[model samples]
Target: MSIQIGDTIPEVTLKHIHDGVRVIDTPTVFSGKNVVMFAVPGAFTPTCSEHHLPGFVARFDDFRSRGVDVVCIAVNDPFVLQAWGESVGVPPGLQMLADGNADFVRALGLEMDASAYGMGTRARRFALYAEDGVVRHLFVEAPGEFKVSSADNVLAHLD
Candidate 1:
């Protein structure tokens, strides 16, 4: 079964670019934090690049003021995630996490097969709000749909 509200985020190592490519486990990232993590199928794809990421970029402060840390994850390398964040002007402090091997998504049961599109294993578009590593809310988009997982939608529900 997929992870749900009240479930603890699974432990897995994920990569991100900071001073260098750093590998951090999920427990370390989510522990003691009010976190909003949103995942995309892949980086640089149209909807992901144009809409999904930008919405979070635009609302980064809204989340921060509420004492929440915002994260964006994709099944791409740390290098690509870094470059994409720079290209889109992602403000500092918004984490760009690389679920490079799809381990994290599979653990959450959110992995989707995009092989038909030649993208191989990918994450479904979804977002979750967690407090101290325990999920409080989850918003998963329907196939080919983008609505509930948007930054605005998540914040609305959070409030």
Candidate 2:
């Protein structure tokens, strides 16, 4: 089963490009913060590049105003994530995280095999809200769909 409301976020190392591929842990990112994290199967894929990430980038301030930290995770390398973020104009506060090994997604039980597309294991498109590391809301999209996990949708559900 995937992570659910009221479950604590799993501890796993994730990467980002900040002065060169910095390492961060889930606990350090989610603890003591109201976080809104969205995951994409892979970076630079059409929907993720054009819609999913851009939606969050456009609404970064909205989330910040509501005291929520926005993060974008993809099962790609830190370099790809950094380039994608720059290409899409990701704001400073909205993190672009790299889950290169799918460890984080596996821990959440949200890993999906995309071997048919030659992508191997990747995260299902999902967005979750957490406060102090405990999940409050989770929006997981059906395969080949994009709706519930959109930034606007997630923001609407935020308190």
Candidate 3:
């Protein structure tokens, strides 16, 4: 079943790029913390590259002040995520985590097959407020839609 509000995140290792090296199995990175994790279809896609990521980057300070740590996840590799974060001007306090194997996505039951689009498996656009590793709020978007999971919407929920 899809992870809903009140569901705790599973213990799954996700990869990330740090100092030009690919680091793997970093599941406890968010442990014991209040985090806002949002997943996108893929990295460098139009909507995701332009609005979705920049929105979070722009409002990162607000999220931090609200005591919410923000992270962006995609099915791409860590290199792509790192480059994308640089290209999009990702701000401080926001992490670009790479769920390249889709383990975490499957754990959350948010995995989607984009094989028809030549993308293979990827994550749907959604945002979750996790307090100390347990979900407090979830905003999942309809297929091909980008409404509720927007940074503004998540901010409203934080308010």
Candidate 4:
């Protein structure tokens, strides 16, 4: 079953590129913090690159002011994620987490098969509000749709 509101995030290791080095086994990066984690189907896709990420980037200050740390996730390798982040000018405080192997996506039960598009396994577009690693609110989009999980929507929820 897909993860729902009130579900505690599973403990999983996510890869990230930090200071030109590959970091592994990092834990509790978001623990004990108010977090807004949004997942996209893939990195560098049109919707994600153009709309989803930029929305979060634009609203970073607002989210931080509301006591929320924002992060974006995708089912791509760390290098690709890092390149994408740099290409789009990701802000310093916003993290782009890589679920490259889809372990984290599977754990959340939010994995989607997009092999028809040659995308292989990917994450369903969604946004979640978490406190201390437990979900407090969730907004998952229907396939091919992008409404409820937009930055604006998440912002309204934070209000």
Q: Record all residue pairs in model 2 with backbone atoms less than 3 Å apart, i.e. clashing.
A: none
Better of 2 and 4 by lDDT: 2
Best candidate according to lDDT: 1
Instruction: Record all residue pairs in model 1 with backbone atoms less than 3 Å apart, i.e. clashing.
Output: none
Q: For residues 1-159, write the lDDT of model 4, one tens digit per residue.
A: 988888888888888888774654424666789999999999899999999999999889999999899988999988998899998889998988898889998999999999999999999999999988889889999999999999999999988
Estimate the TM-score for candidate 2. Answer: 0.98
Steric collisions counted per model: 0, 0, 0, 0
lDDT (tens digit, per residue) of candidate 1 on 39-128: 999889999999999999999999999999999999999999999999999999999999999999999999999999999999999999
- TM-score per model over all chains: 0.99, 0.98, 0.95, 0.95
- Estimate candidate 3's RMSD in Å: 1.3
Ranking by lDDT: 1, 2, 4, 3
The residue-by-residue lDDT of candidate 2 on 1-159, one tens digit each, is 889999999999999999987999999999999999999998989999999999998889999999999999989999999999999988888899999999999999999999999999999999999999999999999999999999999999985
The lDDT values for all models are 0.96, 0.95, 0.88, 0.89
Worst window of 10 by summed lDDT in candidate 2:
88-97
Name the better of 1 and 4 by TM-score.
1
Provide the lowest-lDDT 10-residue window in model 1.
Answer: 20-29
Q: Candidate 2, overall lDDT?
A: 0.95
